[model samples]
Target: MKQDEMIKLGISIGDLNGIGSEIVLKTFDDSRMLDFCTPIIFANTKILNFLKKQYKLSLHFQGIDHPSNAIDGKVNVVNVWKENVNINFGEEDTKIGEYAFRSLEAATAALKKDEIDVLVTAPINKATIQSDKFKFPGHTDYLARELGGESLMFMITDNLKVGLLTDHVALKDIASVITPDLIEKKIRTIQETLKKDFRIRKPKIAVLGINPHSGDNGLIGKEDEEVLKPTIKKLRDKGDLVFGPYAADSFFGTKNYKNFDAVIASYHDQGLVPFKTLSFGRGVNFTAGLSKVRTSPDHGTAFEIAGKNEANLNSFKEAVFKGIEIYKAREEYKELTENPLKKQGKKI
Candidate 1:
């Protein structure tokens, strides 16, 4: 595909001290990826080149000043910085975090300006990346602020998808946050995303309970009975195929998750633990309910294996592929929704 014809993939190079750069280089090293989308990596070309040499990668990339200068058939790097910073592998330096933020900031700008069709972010050290400018916990919060949409952290693979109701919140605060309004909104977001992004026409969603065995029907706790049960009933009455507040303990073990289109967990670990276990290297962390498409690898910054060339690039590659797929799906959905006659004709 030519430049205008192909999707422009905006890539943010995450913490230089981590495996972000390694996976990014390795993923684009495959020549076949270029045929799918034009990758515009947001980071210093000099830094990338240094890492490229360090890893002994044969990937050739051209330096560009902006995303518009990206060419279709080759990897393009936007020089977000020009300074030469020392790269110490496996080190958690604040300076390294600044570079990661710079790349993400620039890539997000391009995305907002329509310079890029989709964004695939590499892993970042959440701790080191914090600054006065970045008060949010992670990418989803920041992207939601910038992109102007309700965002859901949707971890996905081909078969399974998990959405979080309360991500990055403390264990004590999980229940206080799970109100009826919050549950409804999140479920709505998941439902819309499944229909528009994944093309699931009638999505059957399952919700995991906040307490063990769903509070053992109030014997273990009343939050499941008082909060989740009623809220779920309201949604079901509204004709949504939403079920559960199922016991988190046996939900996955019983293979009940396979019966639904997606599972909504109350907190971070409740959903991600089982998800990462099942789809570790193959899953993509997709930020759903945004007007723009954004995805990342399922894993985080592996500081232990930063520059060792021991990083697995499958998740990163899947993130790239998933970003492209969602973008296309959204575009098709827009066309069909904007002109319902065309959709009806297709049905006929």
Candidate 2:
């Protein structure tokens, strides 16, 4: 947040066989953006250069040995691998998966060492990124273990912000994980993120029900009527503007989500299905409750569009800007929290 030093942005190139490199390159093509922050990409220069050629891009990247040695105005690349990896677009192979993990691992190290201010990751093939070393489902699980925080997946955009109770889990596994405790923890994390990261002083959060008709008065399911309603009551008593056990089907369709600052969905699909439907090309997945700042584009690898010069860079660009905004917001929030003010009563 110090204005003296440029915010060093660390990026992990996702599955090389996908549209990660294409979107990343397009996001940094505008040299004027360098005036704001510096980017340090963790990937092989050869791989990115291949993407560049395929896309017919004129942009040049500076190969740096270290993140700290990155130039101010140029797109900086720290080669994580030395080999010239082949570009096999639209394939979920072991080689690209290993490469993606290598880049993410190295970038995460730089983040922990305070070499970068924020991390904006490219999309990785979650199924393929599995290996002996990295066995997590996706970025949230891996980053949660690496950073040691109760990471919650939040989808952010200018229009709406939604966080999930269970992220990157199988549908069968979600039912077991949907305990009252998990719901409460995820909402708490979302509340804190809205306050600290997004700078919402009194965040009004809306929680969605797990069932289609919110259990239809317990005829379909009891979790919504029994678990969610009571949890909202408890969380609200603790001084949070929490509301809802509304059915997910009608919440967004009726334009009700606009009334709250943030929404907590019962699971990943319940939240993301609506979020991506509205803000598909512009949404950013923010990992809230982590000590370090991390975000990624809302969309996935888009294997069909890889190397076709059809990938949209809007989401990736917004991810970088969102990272910078959250970092600044956190700094300001810390300053405000440190200097306490005298208590005052509320006026109706």
List runs of model 1 lying over 4 Å from the truth. Answer: 1-4, 346-348
Q: Candidate 2: lDDT over CA atoms?
A: 0.89
Query: Over 4 Å off in model 2, which ranges?
Result: 340-348
For all candidates in order, the CA lDDT equals: 0.93, 0.89
Best by TM-score: 1
Error of 1 at 70 (Å): 0.8
TM-score of each: 0.98, 0.96
Error of 2 at 263 (Å): 0.6
Q: For residues 73-141, what per-residue lDDT tens digits would candidate 2 score against the true structure?
A: 889999898998977889989888999999999999999999998999999998889999899889998
Report RMSD for candidate 2. 3.3
Compose the digit string of candidate 1's lDDT tens values, residues 170-282: 99999898999999999999999999999999999999999988998799879999999999999999999999889888999999999999999999999999999999999
